[model samples]
Target: MEPMLPEESRFETGLVEVVGGYAELPSGWTVDTPDARDRFDVSRLTRLLRDHERHGRGWPGSGVDDVLVEVSDTGERMRANVVVRDGDEEIRAWGSVHDRAGGRMLFVHIVDRDLPDDVAKVCSDVLFHWAEGQAVAVGSARGLEVQQIDTGAFEDDARQHDWLEGAGFDRVRSWWQMKRPVTPDEATLVPSTDKWESEGVRVRLVGRGADGMPDHDDLRDVHDVLEQAFRDHFNSREETFDEFVHRLREDPGHRWDHWWLAELLDVPDAPQPVGALVATEVSSATGPNGSYVSYIGVLGDARGRGVAKSLLSTVIADAAGRGRDRVTLEVDADSPTGADGLYVGMGWETSYVTESWHRDVPVTGTPRQQG
Candidate 1:
């Protein structure tokens, strides 16, 4: 991953100057680039925003590390972030944009909960306008005619829904945020051996090479399996192998040992991967830590053969072995595969719900693009 531009100019010029539709800041309010020194204030703002979202939901809020990753310039190369401060010099709003992949961008819009409705609305507009400009810049850089700005809101957050809709985004899909408890006894759920086998499917952690990096072939197999498996899923898009790897590594909880691959051994030829699961460690300040399943995909040909189940069981058992108290994951509420049902059957319960919103912004011959 590389910085979008040189260090000296990235913050001074900022994203708003890259395209049209710049939002005018109110009197005495200022928007500026965030750095590591702002982590305390920014994280406090994030916690405030998360607290507002948690009014009716029990979703675990983000940690300071999560907020730091977005604010720190050296943390994520493909991301740009800015904070809005009131006249009192308090950070009232924060906006972040991630060049997620070709033709798609991810936006995070947050405003202080205690602001007056009118002021908060204005802040929302400012963030959305900034996001649109960033999207255009990202699209032009990728040589794309249009870029889809994708964002999410808790299903019950009326304020967020209104803001997103007002910004030309449409409610696209719902997701079930699920969690399942892990018991120490479940550590025996998988075979004691490093590789667990059942009915011709074998599950094991991705191998590490002598250099301590993951085996390239194993990683490629995981990427291929996931890419093919999600092709027909909602809002699926083609992500290059490099982009996929880079994006996942940006997560604060990312760990190499949490990656797993499942292979079919019954075939006549050499065994090939048919399923993959990537997990991350979630920390907790009030209770025991947890494991989060970031990605789980089983090839279409191996779906009915229990590849999904095997991969999931491996994760649960691994979590238990690591003394994690629970495992969490999110599934599409309307998945064609009935993934929600499978998760429920495995003892996962919905803790909260979220919806995806999308707005496609067209990229034309802007001055930046022309140059």
Candidate 2:
């Protein structure tokens, strides 16, 4: 892959250079940073990686914009990427790190699976070590004593399981990647009033303001509803409103029309936001695109009032109205709320499985100096 000339990177150069693993690279191998022009090659690499992991699932994988978000530096959080190239200058391994939120860091470790075992092991070791250093830097910057390094792998990919285990990461959780098909007739699934109401719960799309942005109060309501809903869930973290909006907008599939909020009525007080469903478009290389529920949350106070179901039904109806094919979502297999059961009862079926592997690295000694 060709690096962009006069490159712009948000990566802390001083911190990266001082990281301990570069010397471990073989003499003929080198490390490089990718920029906008490299998105195609990087995206191709991503597609190949996914295909290999899924045993030739034939999925289209990520597009250029997905790679652009990771390789670009315009978002709220800081992220860095490194590609390992052989003497022929072809990329054999790629590692990207993101300071996702306070105390949590995300790592994407991809090494060419076609390489010999020894070569692959070496590349994996180097990338894992480098990720550890990056995690420390991120944690220290946040005045945190330790940072969680979160990464994922396909359930059947034993190679990834081995690499992550070798790097001290534990298989912490499993997720069900579920999908539900939509029919054209379902477009009328939502009432003509553009809302769904049942048992004192009402769901509707978040209203837009005169400026075309979502109403500020409504947006905050969505954020607050989700935060409180997931507060006790696994891996829960406190993300500020600014961070929440910035992260969601970074998605290439984000659409203002896909956002829906739920309210509880017939209560003693004024209507209150009890649930929210944030969805996105899932473009397919062939056939109609689908909708994906990025987040669907209902507050604890409204649990049994059918708020969650109403919000989900609204998205499915919205997707049908758009002539979409399906709706997809991920649910924790071991959720205390029995969310998987809810999805299964609502017509969703598990299409695949993925596992979360994590390692907590302690932030010790001095923080990386800024240049």
Candidate 3:
């Protein structure tokens, strides 16, 4: 509701396991990072993950999934991992272990860079070792050993590739990171409601509360819509309502006005929206502000009713109205809906590519821990 200041980036040096998302690293693996700060009491660790997850990253994400995926709303994914830090307490490396529901894949995301040689090695070691233990635990639970352990690095980071190969991760595939120039004409091209007025669907800016915050009930509906919408998409996870709200608020340019909720309006008692788009202002150190589509979700029932198009149009138009330089978003190269086609149709073009690399790791079974 209120404009937020960009937080100074700081290192959150420790380990954390989020509510439904954190999967604890297996026992017998020491918390080890050479020449690093011991700033990690449990309290500090808790705040670090929450802050890093909800805001620190300069992007939208829920819990652990934020760092690994291009677009995400958190859901039930058991996640746990550690961030290796330096003497200055900045991140040298970070990694996660997760039991993925969509494909029942035991997943890992490990990344590090720009650290002293030994520290860099420690960073890589932390990720590989944790992932190995996690793979074993998953295999034991599923009655088989894990066949692979997956990890990723930027496409051209030769050093990181060397680390991954040394750690036994393999190169998988590349994902495109696209950007598009937004002009007044493109932004203003939002579809009129005239066509959908009779269909009982209306997309409108989220109503504000008397206290001047977003009407959270509608906000929750937006999350619900997105949760339902992404059910068939890759890496779809059930992000907690709290995670959804907090993560969206993390961006400095978050605005209540930019959030839109689309409802099957004619449907009675209390109209529940079947679609939502959470858009935000993108602040630049220089140049005009830009716009971002934080999330665009439409219930399965609402697809083909023009809900997504309307939401996209509104974001572009809003960006143009504010005289922004451009608009941007990420798309999964493996999306089931061919979502990129829609963005391409709307004039977005690929500006760069990111890769997803993966490999199988062996795991030994251990007795399960009770909840």
Ranking by lDDT: 1, 2, 3
Candidate 3 ranges with C-alpha deviation above 4 Å: 1-119, 130-152, 165-174, 185-200, 266-272, 357-371
Sorted by TM-score, highest first, which candidate order results? 1, 2, 3
Query: What TM-score does each of the candidates earn?
Result: 0.91, 0.91, 0.62
Candidate 1: deviation at residue 268, Å? 6.3
Clashes of each: 0, 0, 16
TM-score of 3: 0.62
Consecutive 10-residue window with the lowest summed lDDT within model 3: 4-13
In model 2, which runs have C-alpha deviations exceeding 4 angstroms?
Answer: 1-11, 15-18, 21-24, 39-44, 47-49, 56-60, 267-269, 367-371
RMSD to the true structure for each prediction, in A, is 3.1, 4.6, 9.4
C-alpha lDDT of residue 7 in model 1: 30
What does the lDDT come to for candidate 3? 0.58
Model 1 per-residue lDDT at 55: 55
Task: Give the alpha-carbon lDDT of every model.
Answer: 0.80, 0.79, 0.58
Cα lDDT tens digits, model 2, 43-89, are 65566456555552335356667777777767424677777778877
Better of 1 and 3 by lDDT: 1
Lowest lDDT 10-residue stretch of candidate 1: 3-12
lDDT of 2 at 194: 60
